[model samples]
Every structure is written in structure tokens, then in C-alpha cells.
Target: MNLLVTGGAGFIGSHFVRAVLADRLPGLEGASVTVLDKMAYAGNFANLGPVAESKRLDFVPADASDAPVVGAALRGHDAVVHFAAAGVTGIEVLLEAAHRLDIARFVHVSTGDVYGSIDSGAWTERSPLTPTTPAAAARAGADLMALAYHCTHGLPVVVTRGSDNYGPYQHPGRTIPRLVTALLDGRAAPLSGDGGRVRDWLHVDDHCHGIALALLEGRPGEIYHVAGTVELTERDLTGLILAELDLTWDHVTATPGHKTGDHRRALDDDKIRRELGWRPRIEFSSGLATTIAWYRANPTWWRALQSE
Candidate 1:
């Protein structure tokens, strides 16, 4: 199979690409992969270094929103896996171009944030989208548009909503990497509000594995949730990072947060498990320790990122 993968140089996208090339993802072995990345702030070519020279991999440095470029690239591919931030850019152009170009399958990756925060139980795929932040709202809009295309134009599109992902290659702006990098740099990590906000964290490998399942087995116009196995409060998560670094709370600074909704976020992923037999494998403690080790050992990779 030939696949066109958007944001292939970003954290999760790169993980998927490498997995496919290594034949780690079931049902996609020996697939030829074409990567479309804009080399944006978060997208790094270095992320694909391990498989850069693989005969099955092709890298295209361009924006997915560029219609002419994307439309041309979609011509002969069997499917398109879009892992870019579609809410902010490119989902519309890619979906329209996929329709015009006759691509067979399109996987539109979204985030659990679209469901916003829920104070009680986990949100199922059937949960109503009531995103609070502007970013989440934009992602919600993109999800609706993708489903609409499936309904109106017979496009074979499947959407996957995942929780907070952390692993190697993640940009330092996120909570895990931000705190890890700050503590490494002998600086205090900032925790906004009261540090009570809670979020479910999914490892990137698990997220990509679930997405590969969605790509292979998902029904058209359906939505899948790749929920995290563990949920942690902001303060607790920060404490994990600090503990890993052997630092104390003095290394953390309290700051104002921009949250405007409920303090907790969770997702129920039983649908994907029952329908596709997908479940997360990595435990948070070991996964987080490994992640911290990656940052420590790859100082050159992240130090340059920090300087930028």
C-alpha cells in the first residue's frame, strides 16, 4: 500500500511512519510512505532520522494546506493519514483534495480536548462536543467537517480522538516535555492556576498503534477515542517530573492558567477496544521514566530546540 501521511515529521506522525516502515504496525507492512510536513515550529526533520534513508519513505517539505501540492501528491496513494493540526489548518483543503483525487481512505486525527472538560465520568465517543478553548473549538469544527464530507460526498473518512500524548520528539511546549526540559536546564517549571487541572496522558506509541487500527478497521464516518490509561492532576504530573529529576517543588513556579471550563478531562475508549481490539500497552511510570531518559540522553536534539 502507498500512504500519504501529513505532519510526518511531527512526534506522533513520525512514530506512525517509523512503525509502518519497520512493519511494527499490523496490516500495513511493506507500505510505501510519503510524508507531507511544513517543517513548522513543532515539526522536526530530525524526528525521522532513524528511517530517513529507508527505501519505503519519501519526505515532502510543504504545507498540507497547499492545494495544488497536496492534490498532486494524493494522486496515486492508497490512503491518507492526516496527523497534522487540522483544526488550525489544512483539513478542509486535504478533505476536498482527497475527494477530487479519489483517495480510498482518509484518517483524520483529532484530540479529546474537543469534548472539553468533564468533572465526573469519562466521555464516550457519543459525548457532545462543547470545547472551551479556541484550539479545542477549532478541532471540533474540523471533526464535524470531516464527518460532513463522508455524509455528503461519500468520502471514506474516519476520525480518531486521542488524549494528551507524551514520548520522544514531542515539542517542549507541552506539559511533560516543558517541565522535563526546564528542570534539565536548571530552571523552574511553571504550573498555572492551582495546578489542580487534570488530564489523561497517552503515550505516543500507544496513540499511533490505536490510530493504525482505526485506519485499518474503522467504519466510514465513525469516530474512535484513544483514551489514556491514567489521569493525573497538574500538580501531580509536575511532581512526577520533579521526582524523576530528583528536584523539589521549589523548582516549580505557580502561574495563572487560561483554562475556562471544568477542571478534569477524561475519555472512554471502550468502543475502539471492543470494535477493533485496541488497548494501550505502556504503563505511565515506566513510560515517563523512559521519556525523561530520552530527553537526558538526547541533549543535542532538544538543546537546539530549546535555543529556538
Candidate 2:
């Protein structure tokens, strides 16, 4: 099968590409992949270094918003897995291009943050979008646009709302990598508002696996939740990082956070598990350990990104 994966050089996208090339994901073995990436701040060529020699892999350094470019590259692909963080306009163009190409499956990878902050109970696929942050609002808009394509145009599309992902190749600005890199440099990691904001953490490997399931088995116009088995607050997560690094609270610097914004989030993944038989396989502690070790062992990979 020929596959087009946008933002395939970014953290989660790169992981998905590597998984497909390694035959780790079901239904995509021996597939040829075409990657369209903008090579932005988070997009790095080194992320695909492991699969650099794969004959099935093709790289296109371009923006997803470029309809002419995307349409030309998307031809003859069996499916499109969009992992790019293109705003509403870019998604519209890409979805149109994919629809015109008659792609078999268009999987739009999204985030749990689109549900905003849920004080209690996990957010199901039917949960109302109450985005609080600017980023969340933008994602919510994109999700709506993607689903609309399926409803209004009959373009086959499936959406997966994944929880916070932590693993190698993640940009250093994210919570886990930022803290890990900071602690590695013997610097106090910055914490916001007593570090009590809650997030469901899913390992990048598990996230990609869930997306693969959704891509292969999910129904059109449906949304799936790919969530972690465990949930942790910012304070709890920071504490775990400190423990992992053998540091104390003194190594953390608390900063003020939003007072009126949503502070907690969790997802109900039962639907995906029941319908597609998908479940997160990585344990949080073990996954955290492995991720920390990855950053520790590869300083050069992340050191240059720290300034950006």
C-alpha cells in the first residue's frame, strides 16, 4: 500500500512512520510512505534517521497548506494519515485534496485537549467541545472541519483524540522533555501555578498503535479516544520527574498559571477498546523511564532544539 503522512517528520508523526516501516503496526506492513513535512521548529529530519535507508520511504519538504503541492504528492496513495498541526485552512485544503484523490482512509490525528478541561469523569467521543486555551480552540475548529468533510462531502475520514504523548523526538517545549532536559542541565525546571493541572499521559508508541487501529478498523465520521491508563496532575508529574532524576522540590520553580481556565482532563477510551480492540500497552513508570533514558543518551538531538 502507498501511504501519505503529513507532518511525518515531527515527534508523533515520525514515531508512526517508524512503526509502519518496522512492521510494528498491523495492516500496514511493507507499505510505501510519502512524508510531507514543513520542517518547522518541531519538525526535524533526524527524527526519521532510523528509517533513512528504507526504500519504501519518500520525503517531501513542503507545507500542508500548499494545495497544488499536496494534491500532486497525494496522487496514487492508498490512504492519508494527517498528523500535522495545520490550522483550519490547511486541513480544509488537504481534506479536499484527499477527497479528490479518492483516498481509502483519511485519519485525522487530534488531541484530547479539544475537549477542554473536564473536572470529573472521562470525556467520551460525544463530549461537548469546551476549549479553554487558544491552542485547544484551534484544534476544536480543525476537528469540526474534518468531520464536516466526512458529512458534507462523503470523504472517508476518521478522527482520533489522543491524550498527552511522551516519548523520544518530542520537542523540548513539551512538559516531559522540557523537564527532563532542564534537570539534565542541573537547572530548576519551571512549574506553573503550583503544578496542579491534570493531564492523561499516553506514550507515543501506544498513541501510534491506537491511530493505526482507528485507521484500519474505525467507521467513517467516527471519533476514537486514545488515552493513557493513568492520569497525573502537573504537580504529580513534576514530582515523578524529580524522583526519576533523584532531585528534590528545590529543583523546580513554580510560576503563576491561569486562574479561570480548565485545569483537569481525562478521556473515556472504552469505545475504541470495545469496537477496535485497542488498548494502551505501555506502563507509565516504565515508559517514563525509557523516555528519560532516550533523552539522556541523545543530548545532541535535543540540545540544539533547546534554544528554539
Candidate 3:
């Protein structure tokens, strides 16, 4: 199958592309991929370097908001797995283009952050979106637009809301990579507002795998929650990173009054697990260790990004 992936050069998107090329994702073996990315600050070509020579992979450095470019890119592709966070305008552009082309499947990769903070229990697919941050709000808007295309135009859209993802190739701007890189650089990692915020950390590999399953088997106009193996508070997660790097609390500095948005996030992924048989494979301890090792070994990869 031929697939067009927007934001394919970014962290999660690039991981999906590499997995497809490597045949790591089941049901996607031998599939060709066309990556459309604007190469923003978070988007890195080096993320795709591992599979750069694959004849099955094609790269397009263009904004997803460009209707002409997006419309042209949609041609001759069986499906589109959109991972770009280009907000409502980009999503509309892609949906319109996909509608014209009559694409087979449209997997709109979303985030659990759209559900905002949950004091207790987990959020089901039926949960109402209550995004507090601008980023999550934008994603929620894009998600509604995608579903509208499916309901109004029969565009066959599937939305997958994944938890926080951490693994190799993630930009340091994110929590895990940011703290790991900072600690690795022998600097104090900033802890926000007592570090009490909660997040479910899903490995990028597992997150991409869930996306693949949703793409192949998920029902049209449906939303699936791809949950992580564990939910951890910022303090607990920071402690793990420190222990892994043989650092101490002395290396972590608390930054008060800097916290914003949801203080806790969780998801009930029973729908995806029961319907698609998707579960996270990587454990938190091991996953965190390997992630730190990746940053340590490849300073050039992240150092350059941090310098920019």
C-alpha cells in the first residue's frame, strides 16, 4: 500500500516511517511512504536519516497548510496518516484534498491531552474533549474537523488519541528528552511547580504500532485511545531519570509558577485494546533507560538541535 504521512519527519511520524521501511510494523510491510513535512523546529531530517536510502520512502519539504501542495501530494496515495500539529487550517486542507481524491483511510493522530486533566479514573473514547492548553485546543479542533469530513462527506477518517510518547529521535523540547538532555549535559533539569503533573508515557515504537493497527483495522469515523503502559507523576519520572543517570535531587531545580494546563492526564484504551489488540510493549524502566542511552550516545543528534 502507498501512504502519504504528513509531518513524517517529526518524532512520532519519522518513527512510523522508519518502522514501515524496516518492516517493524505488522500489516505495513513493504508499504511505500510519502512524507510531507515543513521541517519546522521540531521536524528533523536526521530523524529519517536511518531510513533515508530506502526506495520506499519519499520526502516532501512543504507546509501542510498549503492547499495546492497538499492537494498535489494527496494524489495516487491509498491513505493518509496525518501527524502534523498544523492546527485547523492544515487539517482542513488535508481533509478537503483527501475528500477530492476519495482516499481509502485517514488516520488523524491526536493526543490524550485533548481530554485535559482527569482527577481520577481514565478517559474513554466517549469522553468529552476539554482541552486547556492552546496546543491541545488546536488538536481538538483539527480532530473535530476530521470527523466532520467523515460524517458529512464519508471520508473514512479514523482518529487515534495517543498518550505522551518517549523514545529515540524525540525532540528535546518535550519533557522526557528535555530533562534527559539537560541531566546528560551536567545541568540541572527544571522541575515545574513541585513536579506533580501526571502523564502517561508511551514509547514511540508502541505508539506508531497502535497507529498502524488503527489505520488497517479501525472503523471509519471512529476514535481510538492508544494508552501507555504506565502513568507517572513528574516527580517520580524525574527521579527515575536521575537514578538512571546516577544523578541526585541536587541536579533538579524546582521552577515555581511556571506550570500551566492540565495537572493530570490519563486514558482508557480498552477500545483499541479490545478491538485492535493493541498494547504497549516497552516497559517504563527499560524504555527510560534506553532513551537516556540514546541521548548520551548521540550528542550530535540533539546537541545540534538544542543549539539551533
TM-score of each: 0.96, 0.97, 0.98
lDDT of 2 at 184: 94
Query: Relative to the unseen true structure, what is the C-alpha lDDT of residue 222 in candidate 1, on a scale of 0 to 100?
Result: 98
Segments in model 3 whose C-alpha atoms lie over 4 Å from true places: 257-259
Checking candidate 3 for backbone clashes, the offending pairs are none
Q: Relative to the unseen true structure, what is the C-alpha lDDT of residue 166 in candidate 2, on a scale of 0 to 100?
A: 97
Off by over 4 Å in 1: 259-262
- Angstrom error of the Cα, residue 1, model 3: value is 0.6
- Residue by residue across 23-77, what tens digits does model 1's lDDT show? 9998999999999999888899999999999999998888988988998888889
TM-score of 3: 0.98
TM-score preference between candidates 1 and 3, better one? 3
How do the residues 1-308 of candidate 3 rate in per-residue lDDT, one tens digit apiece? 99999999999999999999999999999999999999997799999999999999988999999999999988999999999998999999999999999999999999998998899999999999999889889999999999999999999999999999999999988899989999888889988787889998899999999999999999999999999998898999999999998888999988774445688889899999899999889998999899899999999999999999
Question: Candidate 1 versus the native: TM-score?
Answer: 0.96
Which of candidates 1 and 3 is the stronger one according to lDDT? 3
Determine the backbone clash count of candidate 1.
0
In model 2, where do residues sit more than 4 Å from their true spots? 258-260
Instruction: Give the candidate number with the greatest TM-score.
Output: 3
- lDDT-based ranking: 3, 2, 1
Candidate 2: residue 63 Cα off by (Å) = 0.9
